[model samples]
Target chain A: MATVVAVIASTHHPFYYRASTSTGPDRPPFADEWVRKITAFRETLTRARPDVLVMVGSDHFHQLWLDNMPQFLVGKAPFYDANWYNEEREFGLPRMKLRGQEDLSAHVLRAGLDAGFDLAFSNELRIDHSITCPIITLRPDADLPVVPVYTNIFAPPLPQPKRFVQLGQAIRQIVESWPSDLRVAIVGTGHLSLELGGPRQFGPHGPDPEFDRRAVEWIANGDLDGCLAEVTLDSLHAPGNATHGFMDFMLMMGVAGAGAKADYVDSLDLFHTMEAYFTWYPNGVPEVGA
Target chain B: MSRYLVDKFLYTVDRDPELVERYREDPRGTVAWWESERANDLLNCHSGEASTWLRFADDERDALSTHDYVRLFELGAHPFLTLTLFIAMFERDYEEPLGFQKQYAERLSGFTLPYPDIAT
Candidate 1:
């Protein structure tokens, strides 16, 4: 029997990717700091060596765009490659590859639907930076198999916080029912606090470290409701904070089960963009019984 | 508005009278009322001039709920108008602050607004 061994929620700041491979001196000193943190995190993931890595993150119109977008989508490919946006191509980060867990995707989707979740299934979907950046950080060579779950947290008709928690329960049921001998690690990549575009664009005003600290603290304490309550869609996007991606973290908490404990791994603030990392593991006693 | 005009606009077009009644009763609720009606028409309104109204209907029947319809109003409103109204509303009503309004504005600012061209 395989159990979800670890859950991680962190920011996928493009700045780190760019600075890691950039040629210019304009790259901040903090960029190097991020690389070091990423390297350390990668080593930690490698040591765990889970059979399957379930990643939850937001898609910024990479695969599905304005004309057509699904609220929730699961990837069903057996293997996939990642592409950098038009800007990041100059640095030559080779397209990362990952073995796909079609079985898990199918099971999760089926279980979710059976549990009354409305989700879109994708047999053919391209990997975007949200998935790739963390893949590169955690498994640079991309040897790990992955199950990617996308949330429309940044888009309208965003799933409510309560709904996301329900999603986590649904995922737990699916994982627990699996008849395979596989260990799974779940990773969520997005932001802690920071808005993009508008007056806060790459400025100091938009990144709310106070709220970020509170969120990370609640996760560490296993206070699910406290964390969820603090982040109304409005509070998450308050004037000083623009990053609306923490909903991925909420989903991560759901899958980790209620008593999962989190530890702050790293925090990076660059160009008014704040990125934080936390790793969660299932606690001594499960909150929900089978 | 006359009963005939109301019937023509409401019944002939299949708009919900309850929504129109709410719209007529509360000025602030009118936009939401119209949006709800428009979304209903968009999703279910069939062909002919009436069908154009149903363009926004969900492909799956069970997808839309009363809450979803309300969310569509909150999420789909024009950002500029929403922001201005939100700020005004927040200022007037300090106790029950409108947070989603701000969140919606922040989230949608990046994307192009989806206002349908009335002239078309």
Candidate 2:
């Protein structure tokens, strides 16, 4: 029997990617202070060494379009590019293999449907930056096997918070029923606040410190209802708050189960970007185990 | 305002009059209905306040009021519904807007509907 060992949710602002490539020594989003925090977070995930990494994030119209959009889409590729968005220039594309677990993708799909979720299954899905950028932080060598799940939060008629949480529960059930004995890690990427392609894009693309602190606290405490309440769909979809991805966090919680505890590693308020990162463990040693 | 007018409109749209009246008094309920019934297509429609309405679970309905319904109507609900229903009615009522007489012939475009298996 496989268990979900860890659950993580973090911000995926393009500025973070741009900061990683900057030549300047400024320590704003990618400063030494922030780098150390994110590196430490990644270290915690790597230490877990889950057999499969289930990534829940939003698609910025990378693979599908409005003419034909799936409410919930799953990546069905054997392997996908880890730096699909970084290829805008002369950057080399890095492909991450799934460690021979393509069957798990189909299993998850079937289980999701059994659990009453209408998921969009794609056998030939393309990689996007949201999935790739976080992969760079977690697996620098890009060798980790991943199962990417796409949400329609970026588009309209977004899944309700309850439905999103149910999706996570479905993922947990699916992974638990797998015949193979494996450990799985669940990662949710996006922001607590900070919307893209809007007037909020002035300088630093971060979120409000108070709200971020509250959210981080709730997640660390494993208070699913509290966290869900704190993040209203309207508040998350507000002018500057891109908290729609919090639903992903809720799903991660479902996968981690009720006993999971999270540790806040990094909290970055870079310009208009609110990049908060956390690492959750199922039954590990409690540090700040709220 | 009058029940007769409301009933007439409901009959025209083939919607339940009581449901329409309920929506007039509680737009959030209407939003919930839309989400539960047409979630697949509704998810793709871009309405700024759709998330707000969808987030309201059954438990939270007690907090909603008639003012919210009025606000919903003011916030382009009528236009949205009218446009959507117009499309439906047009497809239902008319054989063809442009007469299907002598056809403007052209080469067959090789486009095909997406295969259901490959597309989830």
Candidate 3:
């Protein structure tokens, strides 16, 4: 049976990558700190050396549009890309293909269906910044076998937050049952508390810091249900939409499950969005206090 | 400055509504404060597209605010600027996607966003 060595999640924004290329005041010291944290997380991924990386992210009106969308879609193809918003010129991202584990992908899809969850599949999944930005940091130069999953955070008629976490457990089960001895790492991306195109979408306003802090606390405490119960859509759909990406966070918690202790958890904010990053270790969430 | 013309105008107009009052009270002075080498001169040479956008700033507050600032970014038939506003918002953060990625970048390998000349 394959061993799931790590479960990692980060609320990734294109700015996290683009700030690497901006000039002057825009590229402040704190901005530099953001990139540093991502790099450190990448280093951690390299050490894990999981044979397969399962990436889950929300589509930002790219790839999927209002006309057609899926709540949960998996990639059965052999590879995908993280290309958009100057990902190459600014983010130091090279255009490279990431491998996909077809057999494992099929098993994941089947596992979701068997668990009584409605799952979708895509054989030709071309990824966007949500998927690529982090990969650029994790493996910039070449190919890393990845299975891509897309969730509908932008569209309406959505599933409850708990569904996302449940899907995460299903993913864990599928990976655990795989016959191959492959090591797997799960990467979940996107954050809550920022409006995409609302009235304040581009305001110079800050997020509801308390909203962001409490959610991070719940996840850090390994309280996925508590996090879910606390973060209502109304809680997210505020003037700032501070918790807009809870689906992404919930899905991440589902994949990591409640048993795994968070080895590391930290949160930060750019003027527009507040981001939380966490890493889980099966052995234990180390004693080093964050 | 054409690079930042739309960005600069929209940001100055929408991001900081207070600047609207400043522009309303003293157009040239406001321009001088925000820009350096005479506001109109810079717009003519560097920020051509943003020239008219600045023009609307000189109108009666109501007319200027109605057509230019509040109406998004339409051009001609009040100019097709709404799409531009949408694009602008999409391209960059109205607030900003701030975090500590750069701190990690500096530690891991002195990474920073590309910087060009502009008074902060």
Candidate 4:
């Protein structure tokens, strides 16, 4: 059976690439602190020393469009091209190509179907910043092969919040049952009270700092019941327009399992939104970090 | 009110560099041309197999033609698409970082919760 080395979740802020890379006059005053926190977060993954990564993120109308959007799709291609023209134009993100783990993707798809997910599979996927931001922050080299799992939080009539949690739970069990000897890490990214294209956008802090505070505590302590009780499709609108992306974090909590406190938890309050990072070692903590 | 077609215009224009420039430089002309020529064409298919019924409403047309993002938001066009395409075309005009974005927010500040239904 494969070993579940680590489970991680974070907020995917596209500006980090330009902010961290920019020099002198162009750099924002907060870039240094952001980089410091990210560096520490990156070390958590480095210490896990996983052989493969199962990346979870949502597509922002890049490849997937309203014509035919999938609620939950898995990339099974041999390689994935990352970033798009709009992402480059907006965020200054560079074009990237990542090697895919086909065998594992196949296993996940087969097992996922049997587990009743009705999972969608794509052979050619051009990923956006949701998956790439984590790669840039946690694995700069981008050496490890990855299985990209895309969830639909952007499009309307999305799957229920509990469905995301159920899918995450299924992924954990399916990966653990895989026949590979390699160690695998599951990493996902989401938002914390973000508002894009709305009146409350670009505020000094997240539109609703109170929601963010409660959200951080929910995830850090693995309070699924408390979190699920408050979050609903209609209720999510109050936090911010795009706060539905937090369901991806709820999905990660499912991956981490209930009542399991994160081994490493940290968050930074950024201008538009709060950036959060969490990691759990399902197996015993690696000796290097311990 | 064909919010789908409104989003399609924003989606198609935002992805193409030439279209973004064209739309930015000539909003009325671009909107007129796009409505007449490309509106019915299925994005994933050949032009011969285009859809015959996908025209925008008069208000939707005027909103997009005039680049009235506030009106577009009220008409139920997806907000994310509106912001991204508008930023691509106008963000460069601002002197400070996120200046245009801040201005955009201020313009829409009158809208409160349950702003508009974006489901299409």
Candidate 5:
């Protein structure tokens, strides 16, 4: 059986690509601190040394549109082209190509279905920044094969918050059941109190700093009951319009398992949104060679 | 009100560099042309299989044609789509980073919570 080496979750701020790379006059004042924090977060994945990554992220009206939106979809292609034209135009993100782990994708689809997920499968998926931002921060080399799982947090009438958690839990079980000898890491990205295209956008801090504080506590401590008790479809809007994306973090909480505190947890309160990073080593932390 | 169609306009225009420019330079003309030529065109389907019943309401058309993002917000157009497309077209005009975005936010500051339903 494949070993579940690590469970990781983060906030995918698209501007990080430009923020970290920009020089001198163009660079944001917070770039150095952001890079330092991301460097420490990157080491968490490095220590786990996983061979394959199961990436969970939400599509932002890119390939998936209102015409044919799926609540939860898995990419089953042999390769995935990362980033989009709009992402390039807006974020200055470089185009990237990532190899896929087809066998695992097949396993996930089959097992995920049997587990009652009704998961949608896409053979050709052009992933956006939700998955790519983590790749840039956690695995800059982008060498490991990945299985992209996209959830619908952007479109209306989305799946319940608990549904996302259930899917994450199922993914953990399904990955552990795989026949491969390779070590696998489940990494997902989400938001913490975000607002886009609304009155509260571009604030000095996330629209609701109080919510961000509580959210970070919930994820870091794996407090599913406390988190779910407060978060609902309608209730999410108060934090910020885009706060529903936090469900992705709830999904990661499911992968980390209830009451299982994260081994490493960190957060940075940036303008617009609160950036967070969490990692858990399911099979105990790995020892690094000198 | 065809919120979906309004979103489709934003989505289609934002993705195409030429359309973004055209929409920026000539909002009324672009909106008029798009309604006739591209509004009914099923995004993922062949042009021959276009939908016949997809057209924007008069108010929606005016909002989009005038680039009235505030009106679009009140009409419940998807905020993310509205923000992204508007940024693409107008962000370049601002001198400072995120200047347009902050101004955009300030313009919508009157809106309270329980924002216009974005459901389609």
Candidate 6:
């Protein structure tokens, strides 16, 4: 049986991939504390050296918009991608190419069906910052095999927070039942609280602060009920709709379930969003020297 | 020039609600004074046809926020989060065969928030 070595969640916010323009050689675009948190998270991934990865994230109305959005989609292709933007393209972040997990993806897809999920399967799935940034930041190796699970929370009638948690559980069972000695990692990437183009629109007053504080606590303690109460569509996006980004965390919390242990926890209050990161050992924390 | 308005307009709205208010107050006056080649190109983006800037110029953000503008002009709000108005409004047929953004998603995924580290 395979071992679920680690469960992690993080912000796939694009600024994370850009190297800072700050002349202050040491100062990165994010706060020093944020930089440290990310580095710490990376260190954890390094130690785990996962052989297969599962990423749960949503598209930003960019690709997966109102046109033909899927509620829950799984990627079975052998690869995926993200286009580098203007200056980043010029400066050369280069369009990234990431490997996919075929055998494992097939198993998870089947499990979802057997579990009564009317899931969508895609062999031609292209990903975005939500899937790319974490790989670049934490896993550096562009060829790391991964399973991409796309969610729908950006628009109305989002899947309940409870459902995401349930998907996490289903994923764990499938991974554990696999016949390889694989070390697996599950990463849920996106925001905690954010708003854009809505009433609170921008700055000085955005991303309901109180909710952010409580929600992070709930996640750290694995409190699903607390999260469900706070994750209503209205609160997620009153002034701006970006609050949907939090869906990733909800799914992640579910995947971590009751037995997961918190190895590290931190949050960075960026201008438009409250960025957060957490690492968990599903069964128990890994040994230091191992 | 067309790209500049979309990019700059988005940046301004995200950081300067004040500018948003001003645009709301005098849409024509505000956009007119801003010198640019494609400053009026947004009006042409009405479902991929050339309408009149005057149509949207008077209502400030009202005309601009219309479904047409959101869906056709700026593509979507993801552009507001970055300076790459080009990505939001423009594209190249390169990333083919590898999960390339359906249409508007490439712009959304690549936008870099105007981090404080870079100049806001």
Query: Against the true structure, whose DockQ is highest?
Result: 5
Name model 3 segments beyond 4 Å from true. A21-26, A85-96, A202-205, A283-290, B1-85, B88-120
Q: Which stretches of candidate 4 lie over 4 Å from their true place?
A: none
lDDT of 3 by residue, A80-107 (tens): 7546433443344445567789988988
Q: For candidate 5, what is the DockQ-based docking class?
A: high
**Which parts of model 2 are misplaced by more than 4 Å?**
A24-30, A82-100, A203-207, A239-241, A285-290, B1-120
Off by over 4 Å in 5: none
Pairs clashing within candidate 4: none
User: Could you give me the TM-score of model 4 versus the true structure?
Assistant: 0.99
10 residues in a row with least lDDT, candidate 3 chain B: B111-120
Look at candidate 1 and tell me the lDDT of residue A56. 78
Task: Say which prediction, candidate 3 or candidate 4, comes out ahead on lDDT.
Answer: 4
List each candidate's DockQ score.
0.03, 0.02, 0.03, 0.89, 0.93, 0.05
- For candidate 1, give the lDDT of residue A12: 77
Q: List, residue by residue over B39-117, the lDDT tens digit for candidate 3.
A: 2333213444333333233332222334233222112111112222323323343343422222211222321111111
- Please give the lDDT score for candidate 6: 0.63
Q: Give the Cα lDDT of each candidate.
A: 0.58, 0.56, 0.60, 0.95, 0.95, 0.63
lDDT of 1 by residue, A73-131 (tens): 88889987665332143233456667899888888888888889888977777677778
lDDT of 2 by residue, B1-120 (tens): 122222122223323334544655555565456445533333234754242222333322322223232222222222123222223323233464211110110111121111011111
**TM-score ranking from best candidate downward:** 5, 4, 6, 3, 1, 2
lDDT of 4 by residue, A1-290 (tens): 99899999999999999999999999999999999999999988999999999999999999999888899999999899999999999999999999999999999999999999999999999998999999999999999999999999998999999999999999999999999999999999999899999999999999999999999999999999999999999999999999999999999999999988999999999899999999999986777855
Interface RMSD of 4: 0.6
**lDDT per residue, candidate 6, B1-120, as tens digits?**
133344345444333445445544555455555423333344312555432442223332343443223332233333234323323332344454212223334333343343111111
User: What is the two-chain DockQ of model 2?
Assistant: 0.02
Compute each candidate's TM-score over C-alphas.
0.66, 0.64, 0.67, 0.99, 0.99, 0.70
The C-alpha interface RMSD of every prediction is: 15.6, 21.7, 16.5, 0.6, 0.5, 14.8
**Candidate 3 CAPRI category:** incorrect
TM-score of chain A of each: 0.88, 0.86, 0.88, 0.99, 0.99, 0.89
